[model samples]
Target: MDPVDIGLWGVPLAILAGAIRVSTPFLFVSLGECLTERSGRINLGLEGTLIFGAMSGYAIAYETGSPFLGVAAAALAGVVFGLFHGWVCKFKGVNDIAIGIALMLLGTGLAFFFGKPYIQPVAPKLPSISLGGWSDVPQVQAALQVNVLFLFGAVLAVFLWWMFRATRVGLVIRVVGDSSDAARAMGLNADRVRLLSTAAGGAFAGIAGAYLSLYYPGSWNEGVSSGQGLMAVALVIFARWNPINCFWAALLFGGAGALGPALQSVGVSEGYYLFFAAPYVLTLGLLIATSSPERAMQGAPAELSITK
Candidate 1:
């Protein structure tokens, strides 16, 4: 194929790869947030949790030479963060959003403080699957090197979707999220449910962080996250708190993120910054399209404040 034909053809292929690569973290974090939101709370501190998870995962992997161990440590850190968020929100007159922002700053500061030392080291990377083993082209092989986390995220999405629809625990979470008063009437421990859900959400966010440091970027750095944590909150909203939709929305965001680099590689350099902003632009557009001033006020949770 001619260079032009290759470029044209490769764009779509590259986009597909990028979508898978970039969407993995989004998938994890969004699913986590979906769980948290479904329980009638939001944790904005995922940004910090993500960065911290990256640092913890990278540090553990580097020290033990085990990527799996690193993932476990990262998840532990996420659980801790989630517990902290839950604990704080359980107090009287505490603002969850404000606490979320504070936790974000705290997580970022902690990551920067500890991540400085591990900046230069290399850690074990996650294994990839070669789905295109039959292909002869190097580009095809490279593109086919899929992350294991992506598959896990896919499976988790399907599992969560099923659980939410069919499981008793999922029913409890939905009950708590949709109406805490009803939960109280049913004699369910609303606070405990929220706490557990929040911690699980944080653990998933941490796993997303692990993917960033140990796989995609493959190193620990203060700047490892780059607002993916925050964008994920927006993604959860766009997904309508559905785990299955979170998967597709994450892939879309991932594709938008890859547009700039893909275009640049093909010598389309104009408006590079705009390309970089594609995900955020899409996010804003989707938010505007989905949000209704009247409907949101009527349908939004009484205790939840983001919509207000």
Candidate 2:
């Protein structure tokens, strides 16, 4: 009966809420992929990393009574997976993409095998801040309760942008990403840089998984992620590999992801289900529009596989 609940005017409100919730994982995953790609490596197995992190975070939170700790556990798990993937790809004749697919299967199989018992347990949800305190309506209050991780991600994006522009390490990453040979000429360790970047990226992906099970929707299930990890590849391209752009891009993708729910919340049920496909459709359209294999994206890393 709340005025803020499901009215025609509430369509924008529902979208705003849904975008914040759905975009968290996308934001993290895309950022992770952005980092890895900037290091000239591709990690398609992030899908597995995400699901595994979700399962790990949920199970740990259930046992430890701390959602934040669960988030840490998820990041740790993601690091392990990312490092393992990086390690394997370092070997001679190993294809990074192929190994990523294998790792995806491995992570998922492990999560499903181990996460079975934690499915029904109700873990404590992460704490959120009520930014809509001025509103008395329950829906408005719920809609404005922002998660801390999202804020963390926003700050991280800004920091990374600054790092890339000003810091020596950022310069090193950029140089290495642009040309491994140039990095070697400058006495930088290309493989090590890539491995570290890959691991760091995985850590971000892990946080995304944590956000999934410990917060919004708040559950550990096999179906918790709907290919958000894979979609991140396209998102990175859409954002042109800029960390700052990634933030806005994530919100856009999130809005697309929330399109169906937003429409449905306003009682426009017809064809709303199709709107669920909006993210994928948008990605496909972008890829098609930029379909020049010989040309690099405006800000794409020079050594990135896509650029090659």
Candidate 3:
């Protein structure tokens, strides 16, 4: 292909590739947060959990020469963090949001502290499926190398969506989230439900971290996660706690993330940082548009302080 043809076709292909690469973390965290929020709780500590997961997953994978094991370790770490958060919030006076922020800080600090040595070494990267193998073009082949986590995230979204509508367990979680009192009347243990849901959410966040460190960027560093975890919370809100909506919203955020680099590659690199900020800006604007003083109060869980 000539330069012009490459620019026109290659750039779009790269953007799509970037979108897929960038969206995996959002997919995991957003869907995880969807579960947590649906259980009538929010865990913002996922930001910290994500970074820690990245660090731990990379470190373990490097040491063991097994990427899957690294992912498992990351999930375990996330579950530990989630359990801590759940335990703390179980107390009557503790604030889940405040705890989430604290956990975020804690998780970040822990990752940085432990990740210093591992930062220098490169670990094995996750394997990608090359669906574009039929194409002879190198660029097409590279663009078609899809991450396994992307497929996992998609399957998880569909499973959760179905579970929420059809499963008794899903019904129980929704009931707990919608009304603890109602759940209690139904003889369901609300605290236990929230605890398990939050922990599972954290595990998902860890898997996201694993994908970041062991796959895309393919290494561990303190700077690996730049607010993707927190942004995912906003994403879940924008998605209205729907796992299916979370999938589309994550892809949108992913596409927004690719805008800067895609523009730069085309020699239109002005306002690079602003392009990087596009996802956050879009997220903020969505939040403002969706939120109404009256309606927020009506739609938000009575226990949630954000709307109140």
TM-score of each: 0.94, 0.95, 0.94
Considering summed lDDT, which 10 consecutive residues are worst modelled in model 2?
1-10
* lDDT per residue as tens, model 3, 205-304: 9999999999988888888987999999888877877899899899889888888888787787778888988888988988787777654444444445
RMSD of 2: 1.6
The whole-model lDDT of each prediction reads 0.87, 0.89, 0.88
Evaluate model 3: give its TM-score.
0.94
> What's the distance in Å from true for residue 104, model 2?
1.0
List candidate 1 stretches off by more than 4 Å: 1-5, 294-303
lDDT of 1 at 137: 67
Clashes of each: 0, 0, 0
Residue 128 miss distance in model 1 (angstroms)? 0.8
* Residue 189, candidate 3: C-alpha displacement in angstroms: 0.7
Cα error, candidate 3, residue 285 (Å): 1.9
Runs with alpha carbons beyond 4 Å of true place in candidate 2: 1-6, 293-296
Maximum-lDDT candidate? 2
* lDDT per residue (tens digit) for residues 96-116 in model 2: 898889988998999999999
Error of 3 at 307 (Å): 4.0
lDDT of 1 by residue, 1-308 (tens): 21233656677777888888988999999999888888888899999999999999999999999998999999999999999999899888888899999999999999899988899989999988989789776666777889999999999999999988999999898888777799999999888998999999999999999999999978888888879999898888778778998999999999998898788767888998889889889888887876787643343344455754
Off by over 4 Å in 3: 1-4, 294-303
- What is the C-alpha local distance difference test score of candidate 1? 0.87
> Of the pair 2 and 3, which is ahead by lDDT?
2
